[model samples]
Target: MYADDTVLTVADKEIEIVGRNTHLLFEQTKQYCTANDLVLNENKTIQIIFSTRDHTTTQNITLPGLENKSETKYLGITIDSKLTWKPHIDTLCKKLSSSTYVVRRMMQKGGLDTAKIAYFAL
Candidate 1:
């Protein structure tokens, strides 16, 4: 029933109803956890409302304690409410740059094949 991350979805013309259903599901989940001698970690939990329409209007699921986030990293992939890939691309670029720096350092230390550097950059 659970994995490192999960994506739940419901369709409705009214966005609020979808939010409400999500809230109810969370409540039921909390109850199930309680009955099983487990606790839901509110601190690690967050909600994200996705919509192509007005972002402001999507904020209907207001649980008393949990915070909602515009972007979150789920199992290493960066996902935002707007579904933009900028964050993921930025992360990849950072790693690429760091790795390239390491390869350049290796080339400087010894006469490593220049072709290896080009290969690593790719």
Candidate 2:
């Protein structure tokens, strides 16, 4: 048995309070997993602080088991701390380029009809 794609979201105006609450929630999750005989994959866990402004003055959020990340993927969308869509758009562009390459290859091998089908399938 395994747990996949578990996410915990804690929001606050102040970063420090959010960090403290996040740590509490993390500890609780760990305890719950232990009681249920499940192992939490700490290595796969990450902490991302979402803020409109850059948090230069504030210290980095430090948790024992999870590494802090500037961005993370959730539900196939790349989310950055600033909540900008740049990362997600970049990822989408790369995927579209790959699909375009496949369609071009199909056109070379078969014809325009095959390429059209491939493009629609993608």
Candidate 3:
């Protein structure tokens, strides 16, 4: 069995402390994976910093060996460093738009009843 899609978060008042703690935790996680006969895929791993600074300032703040991402999806929710709802709202809008299209198609092909069913199902 493989363990996957794990998320780790570290926070501190100081960026340096956060980085150091994250590094230590990452190392410990690697060791645990090794003992459990699991392989950690670094390529799929990413780090995101939550801060009020400009995006550019946070862009370079990384957790040692991991890539930094401006925004990422966790548990199907989009989160950004600013922790605003924009990203998640945008994603939700896109999904709703697609569902609207499907419902519209059902109305054209089937009827109002079919469209209502599809919309309610969604």
Give the lDDT of residue 121 in candidate 3.
99
Distance from true position, residue 88, model 2, in Å?
Answer: 0.7
The lDDT values for all models are: 0.73, 0.84, 0.83
Off by over 4 Å in 2: 57-60
TM-score of 2: 0.84
Model 3 scores a C-alpha lDDT of: 0.83
lDDT of 3 by residue, 4-114 (tens): 888778877877677678778888999999999988898888887788875453423465668888799988899997999999999999999999999999999999999
Candidate structures ordered by lDDT, highest first: 2, 3, 1
Work out the TM-score per prediction.
0.75, 0.84, 0.82
Model 1 lDDT per residue over 24-109, tens place: 88778778777877756778778777666764565566567878788888888888878989888898899889878777776787
- lDDT tens digits by residue: candidate 2, 1-122: 34468888887887888778877988898888888888888888888877788787445356876788989899899999899999999999999999989999999999999999999999
Candidate 3 clash pair list: none
Model 1: clashing residue pairs? none
Q: After superposition, how far is residue 52 of candidate 3 from its true place, in Å?
A: 1.9
